[model samples]
Target: MTIKNQYGIVKIAIASGKGGTGKTTLATNLAAYLSGKQKIILADLDVEEPNSGLFIRVERKHEEIMYKMIPGWEEDKCTFCGLCQEVCNFNAVLNMGKLILVYPELCHSCYACSELCPEGALPMKKQRMGVLKHFSNGKINFIESKLDIGQEQAVPLIAQTLDYVDKHSENESLVILDSPPGTSCPVIEATKEADKILLVTEPTPFGLHDLKLAVETMEKLDKEFVVVLNRYGVGNAGVEEYCKENDIRIIAMIPDDRQVAELYARGKLVYKKSSAFREALDRIAEYILEN
Candidate 1:
């Protein structure tokens, strides 16, 4: 189904509150299945270590340098009043006893140092945090952001990757974003403005707890979401009960299939081998189309 929202694109984010919960497995397979019928791309926003690319072989289309501006010390403009240090919550700016040290690697690029710099001593400098890579293999379009080593912030790269998708896929039908795990700033950036969010979760207690956190985040962001219960038979019924009690929709359940796991271990798409996984994704895709 070619679903389009106000942005002229259907942005569906596949996310999980905890890692190893099968978000990449769901996103890649869903995108691959949908790509046959629609103009779609799978964006791997887990820049810290993007593994979705390993599942699919894609020809490199292009690359763009994603940069973030951070504070740069200007010794000429003096006056280290410690305001920059006080304002920084990330501890990026360390007002040394003599030399005011500015660690761009540690900085979140919040501009607290530059904005509050009374002396304008710390000017903004361009720091290459990552590169957004675009790939295409006939019908399958893929995009992923790779963060440079020592770069602490991932939200900027995620935003850049989404911007790349928008610039190229404005007329396309769907953009499935593989969001980073946890309800953190990076996850927030990845899920923002998504037409629908498919939360991947398991049946364990930890899974349910983190799913609750993810549900809270979705509620706080006022985004519509449904839970995809991965490894359905492995854990307790807590997640299902919580979803039922909270009135959350459990869209699809991908059973604990050894075939799926074996295919995944081989760096293959589990849906391609297992009928159960394919059926699960088909149900979720139909739900998206219907809704």
Candidate 2:
């Protein structure tokens, strides 16, 4: 099948500038709303702290151990030259007189140490970072990445998960991806071939500022996108005015409600409980379809 037809199923990515902006909340509810209405894949690309599973409660169907490259010290070939430490940008290795100490948490798996180790004292080893979990809730496919606590880079995990989705979704489905916070590499990887990018932001100054950065990033990627005003009453009205002035479409607006907060605290998808939010989510789905 052609990629255009494969992708014509509609891929929507919901992302934000920073964390705690209700990005996942919006993504999850939207996925829930589109659950039976269409063939949908709900992907949570927040590898570091993916919380979509907590709300969706889907039965995990497939999981794989995620791995990354780390330095393996070879004691026999050790020159104790300390060049590895010098070239190591993450400070993961420290050589102290006949002993090589490795702080795994400090390593970025950049392979600079092994490359610069003249004595070949360092080798690359695969280390488990986390798991790529796949689940199914009714007709919706749920995918999530949970990075190991100390593992810093989530880009690889996100890339691998997206690859999994692309490979596994051969049947064609409306893929709605929940991207990680910040317009960083992980977010970029998640939203990479997306048909529509939804920037979810609040009304606060930080929200507006970060949204602008995210919007700029999407514009550079040359992807079709729109904005979703989340937590509509947190701060100034500048985001709305900015969207209007910039000719950016406001696809949906979710008002800040204590009940929503309560549902979130209880780890639940709002569409499961609140009819209003469900209706709003349906409208968001309709907007996505119309656009």
Candidate 3:
């Protein structure tokens, strides 16, 4: 299947309700498949544990540290009025009469504490949270962001990675975002700007349960999304039945193959070896291009 340039840059986010659901598999192979015919920008937005770079062979072109703003306490300027602590809704600031403590992890970077400080004791300062790397191999441009160990928030890093993708992608490029799993703040931040979301799930009972939560999340966000059933032949038809009952579209079903697993274990792309996997990717690419 060939993609026409009529759609401009189509941002497609591949996400799942849980981990180990082949979210990275679908994302990596789909980007590789599409890169054969067109320019593809594949971004791994799973900042906490990004692993999409494992499957693709690309040279790192750029790397940068990502930072988030947190309030810095200036004790000399403080009047001990306790206003900063009161204005912080996240409990990041604490007032202890003689001294104030600021917890960076608890800070949401809303700037409320800094902006509302009456004595200018609280100033917003940058704190390192993650690192973003840009990689490429001719047709495929890969971007991955990884959060620093012990970083509590993924939304800020994910947002920064998306900004990088937006700034670098061309108008005709197909941008595919590999989002973090689950229906949480990180996933929402990763897929918020996507033109369409593809939720990958298995055929098991757990898959169906989490898929329901993911569907509900997309519905609340009013985002257009479809399902892609991974490990199709291993589990029961519960996920299929649930999708049918809900009138949700299943765009593609990747079959369960041991060779696929073997290739994946070796950090290889299954589409290069398995024809069935390639065919499923083609279906997904066609759906993306036609829509």
Candidate 4:
């Protein structure tokens, strides 16, 4: 069932307002299901802790270290002008009379301090932040980026991963982004350019609360999005009611099945074993193609 759409390179982002809501489950299984029909690229943009590759079996095609630009202080070229510290909004640069310090964790890569330095003492340098790996199993191409253990930021790595996808993917192939869990900067960077976003959530009070936050964020970004309720048979109807009140569409509801959990625990995909799960994936794929 290759999708024939007028839009080139349809990008669908699967995200959640909070963690542990079956976001990766949907992403991995959907990619697996779609790969049976046409070529697809599944990108795990949750660089802080990407786990989509756990459920997938792929051979590594390429790997590279990811870096972010940060100002490096050179004392030999400094005259203690204090310009670098004054221009740094993130407090990444500090002048202590005789010495200067640059914090790579705090730097946002705006290059303000380095670019405006009169003596050119602060030079923009590449600082290791993460690593990106590309893998493939014929039809399914998987890209995963993992942030360094002590890295403080994730947006830079997420941005670079998307750039890699843009360069490698064909205009007609489908690209599914497994975004980070939250409405923060990393999530925004992952989904901002997506053609459509599927916000996954469980049907609980906590899920409803975070779903509201995610919904508000999509509204602010003016993005076209829908909701998917996971573990649907156990929780209350708060998610359904809220979606109805807000006129938000509930695209699919995956039932709470213990068999699904058992397979997931073994790092196995459920679409091949669970008919219910495959039905949900069919609906999701149909929605993506129709819209």
The TM-score obtained by model 1 is 0.92
- The C-alpha TM-scores of every prediction are 0.92, 0.86, 0.96, 0.97
For residues 122-213, what per-residue lDDT tens digits would candidate 1 score against the true structure?
88899889988889987778999999998888888888888888877857568899999999999999998688999999999989999999
In order, the Cα lDDT scores of the candidates are: 0.87, 0.82, 0.91, 0.92
Write the candidate numbers in order of decreasing lDDT: 4, 3, 1, 2
For TM-score, the strongest prediction is 4
Better of 1 and 4 by lDDT: 4
Error of 2 at 240 (Å): 1.3
Candidate whose lDDT is highest: 4
Q: Model 1, poorest ten-residue lDDT window? A: 1-10
lDDT, candidate 4, 1-291, per-residue tens: 676467568899999999989999999999999998888999999999999999989999999999999988888999999988899898988999999988888889999998899999988999999899999988999999999898889999999999999998875789999999999999999999998999999899999999999999999999999999999898899999999999999989999999888888899999899888998998898889875
RMSD of 1: 2.0
* Predicted structure 4: lDDT: 0.92
Error of 2 at 273 (Å): 4.4
TM-score of 2: 0.86
Candidate 3's clash total is 0
**249-273: candidate 2 lDDT, tens digit per residue:** 8877888788898889988778777
